[model samples]
Target: MRILEGAGTYVATTSNHWEEHLEVPDLSCGTYSLPAGGTDPQSPHTEDEIYLVTHGRATLWTPSGSAPMGPGDVAFVPAGEEHRFIDIVEDFAVVVVFGPAEYSRAESDTD
Candidate 1:
């Protein structure tokens, strides 16, 4: 059992295209603030991904095509689908959830 305060681990900054915070296994949840016109090319994922917009707007570019998403918008990318995000506003922040628990990235202990 664990608890994460999004406001703590999450932050917006330059030089870093985005920030990733592993809240827990099978659930690498975090917030992202993509600079305007920034784009992340297609990437592979071992499991399904859910992206929920917390602020600003973005355009998702999948193999199928591009779709606009904004605050209160949620997008689900099926497993194995090649997808990326583009045309993001500087004020954008999104929460992501990767399911099946087992597929979540293993955490490293720091003692």
Candidate 2:
């Protein structure tokens, strides 16, 4: 078995956020952290995504609505729903799981 040190390997940027690949099995699982005012590109997902906030606060913006998310908050984004994260605080960290997890994610512009 292997251990992942989340604090050391976390990527940071001024614009888009960073994601470190911990493990992507049939179900994708990893820890994601978003810096203050960071925003992500909009895209349609092939699998459902569950975000469990473990730190700070954030707001998930979708075509449907904007909702506040903080520590202990959980958000489930259904497949095919175009969505993105916004209004991130400096310590926003969450564990994300993408179910079915068959789809591959590339660092391409999902505009």
Candidate 3:
């Protein structure tokens, strides 16, 4: 099995807003963060995604509806669904997991 030490520290120090920490054929994991009141710039992913909030507060919005979020909150978005985090109430951070690994579908699409 693989091990990652200081994963949180690395994510906090990363240059980008998101950091991918692990990946394999079936799944991937990463950390995503945003400042208070920041806009989410992501489009829908090609693979299903799950988010486990570790810090701050926000709202998860989708075509179906929306729900308030905060530390320890969890959310899931299916592939190709329109969704985003909005009304961020504080500096937010979440651990994200993707099925079939993120971008794996994008590669197949280009073929």
Candidate 4:
């Protein structure tokens, strides 16, 4: 077993947008952050994803429409679906989980 010890602190202090903490064959866990007015540069992923918002407020935009999210809210995005965070009203911090590991399905996607 492994531990991320102080994941929130690391994520909050990191300079990068995504700070990955743990990974195995089927799952990967990390933290995703965006400051108010920051751009969401992420695109669709090869694996399914879930985001647990631990701080701040934002609008989650998908091809279908948009929804507001904030502290304690959770989100799930199926693989290959287009989605992004927009209109960030406060600093956002989220715990991200990916199934089958992030980017792990990219190679198989060709088939």
Which 10-residue span in candidate 3 carries the lowest summed lDDT?
7-16
lDDT of 3 by residue, 5-104 (tens): 4333323332238888899999998888877868887899999999988888889999999999888888899999999889977778888899989998
Against the true structure, whose TM-score is highest?
4
TM values, all candidates: 0.71, 0.72, 0.86, 0.87
Which regions of candidate 1 are displaced past 4 Å? 1-3, 7-10, 15-26, 101-111
- Predicted structure 3, TM vs. truth: 0.86
The candidate scoring highest on lDDT is 4
Total clashing pairs for each candidate: 1, 0, 0, 0
- Taking all chains together, the TM-score of candidate 1 against the true structure is 0.71
Q: What would the TM-score be for candidate 2 when compared with the true structure?
A: 0.72
Give lDDT per model, in order: 0.65, 0.71, 0.82, 0.84
Clashes of 3: 0
Model 4 segments more than 4 A misplaced? 8-16, 108-111
Residues 1-111 of candidate 2: C-alpha lDDT, one tens digit per residue: 666566323355555444545545567666776677776675877878888887777888899999988888989998888887788765577777777663654345764
Q: Candidate 4 residues 1-111, lDDT tens each?
A: 677764543244323388889888999998888888778889999999998888888999999989999988999999999999999888888888999899888976558
TM-score head-to-head 3 vs 4, winner: 4
